[model samples]
Target: MDSSDTPSPIAEPLPYAEVTDPTYAEVAAQNFTVEEVAPDTHVLRGTCPRCNAVLEVPLVGNVFHGMRSIRDVLRKRHTKPSAGDRVEPVICTCEDAHPNRPEGRSGCGAYWTLLLTTEAK
Candidate 1:
């Protein structure tokens, strides 16, 4: 069989600047809150309350609920998240004492991170 017979793998499109660019710091500046809906599960749904922008983090299966940072949410949202997805906090850049703030706005510019958990499929 000719190797060319098979189609090339498709590359996924990158998320919007608001989702990927570190320079776009508004998302970090925005206010949000996390809510627990069940044991070992959570529904992170909030907006940049200051800007009225919609922010959502939905855990599907075996994932556990815990504190997470803005960057973590952005990373998962841009990547492939499925059932048993574990999310947690590693660092943050938000000025409001958020867990994910790494640069902390004044230092290297605002950035955040979230801890992720998931079960093997």
Candidate 2:
């Protein structure tokens, strides 16, 4: 067929759906955790292993080498905290943390605690 006679391909638009608030399940699937460390301070933890940086919520302060999982503890890698850092336990959904999923999601729960630490000189 001649170039001029050839029909051009038509581009189709992607089907769109209205954006809605994500359900607790969806957010939970994303593994979002909220925990209170101290008065006015909170923690929002994620599943990313490299997310070792402990952030003090509401106050927006951060402390390196904060609490970590047993897996992280066994790894025993040295991490340093800057001038303003505090160590707080991770809030997670694990067998050690909660006996059962309080929200009705079979195995979901939160474990929040303070991290025992030896500060760097």
Candidate 3:
């Protein structure tokens, strides 16, 4: 117990940056996919392209969809997508940034991108 305990600290949540550095060798880059639930709702799931660990980001509840009609769609889902193209900002925020560094687990902070899809949608 210290004097600092009396003053609580408030800070931003984890996954601070929207996207991590791509050049870094250990940035835990991930491959993300967007799932359109309804018309304006979506869930972004990022999986390490070559490893285990999945991060799901939900874009809904009138935050990004602050104002949307029931008929709004993404026009076109990602077609012929590449990891480097459709994916940009990705980071590894798994398990409190992996302080303990679990074994066999890829808390390694590497980087990846979306899977390359070659199809006409």
Candidate 4:
């Protein structure tokens, strides 16, 4: 094919998009690995499916770190996972400054639920 006939390659990084698609989260979970960092804390390390930035989630006792600490404090409520607790929610808290991110939020606005397996925890 002629050079001019080929599609132009992208010249810039994709702009940040604020999305909460479950599919993105599902893809992310596939890349995550859970490790017990402490007796009471387990951390999930992986890359963000939406932005491809490294991200970490810590499960301290019954709490997942960084994901909802601020909101729980502001609301004056502490919610715990229900019995069995087979699934935990996760959000991208990647450090890269993605363009168009909201004023007070972090990550690329992607969120998803992570399954807690017996071997992973």
Candidate 5:
């Protein structure tokens, strides 16, 4: 118990006009969904599948084929995005919008991948 002896509760702040603000076609109509977190690594939770524009809080997304998409469920993969040894790919996409990553990079302009499996840990 080292977090200030724990036990802190203070909540109640999400009432922004009945909290109704989810567009982008209702979050691309819920697509792209994966979660393996270990055994190789995997964490693709619907949306951002290429310019659908990051959505979080239900409802997923799936644009054409150029924003980010990687769902390699097994077969030993790692083009980089997780499980260390960063090489690039994790829904990567700044669209080569150039600015040199790292400095608070949340996505590059190209390269992508992040849902590989097949135990490498």
Candidate 6:
């Protein structure tokens, strides 16, 4: 198997920038992948569609009910609607240093909400 032949998750690297936009959330929804690390616990992993930096947001508690209110999701849910799915706000917490990024802050300064689903154990 040739590693070079494998497709990268991020097609191109984007320079870090400190900004937040709802459009980025739409792109992020497509980029993120969900992984169940434990019972009722999951992690949303993906690359920032804005800055192309890696991101991971942990989710705990009831996936559908206790995560966030539907009203909040509606406000932050910039992406297409997914019926019966829970929306969780995700922020870029990547450790990579970006130029001009504020001190004490991590990642490229991007945040978005992702539609998450739960499966019976």
Best by lDDT: 6
Model 2: residues with Cα > 4 Å off, grouped in runs: 1-77, 93-121
Candidate 4 Cα outliers beyond 4 Å, as residue runs: 1-11, 62-83, 119-121
Tens-digit lDDT string for candidate 2 (9-64): 96442222212232322332244444557754545544422222223233234343
Ranking by lDDT: 6, 4, 1, 3, 2, 5
| Candidate 2, poorest ten consecutive residues by summed lDDT | 13-22
Q: Can you give the lDDT of residue 108 in candidate 2?
A: 26
- Candidate-wise lDDT, in order: 0.41, 0.36, 0.40, 0.62, 0.35, 0.64
* Candidates ranked by TM-score: 4, 6, 3, 1, 5, 2
Please provide, for model 3 over 96-120, each residue's C-alpha lDDT reduced to its tens digit, 9 standing for 90 to 100: 3433455555343544332222222
RMSD (Cα, Å) of candidate 6?
7.9
lDDT tens per residue, model 5, 9-47 = 854322111111223223322364544444534445555
- Model 6, C-alpha of 21: deviation from truth (Å): 2.3
lDDT of 4: 0.62
- Candidate 1 per-residue lDDT over residues 1-115, each given as its tens digit: 6998989997542222222344333354334445567765665554432223355555544445444544444455545656555434322222332323334241112224443
Candidate 4 residue pairs that clash:
none
Clashing pairs in 2: 63-85
Off by over 4 Å in 1: 1-19, 23-26, 48-52, 61-121
lDDT of 6 by residue, 1-121 (tens): 6999898785444446766786776676566666667787867667887777777778777644333322244453545655556656777888876777777888877776665543344
Which candidate ranks first by TM-score, i.e. highest? Answer: 4
Q: Report residue 2 deviation for candidate 5 (angstroms).
A: 74
Model 3, residue 102: C-alpha shift (Å): 16
Clashes of 4: 0
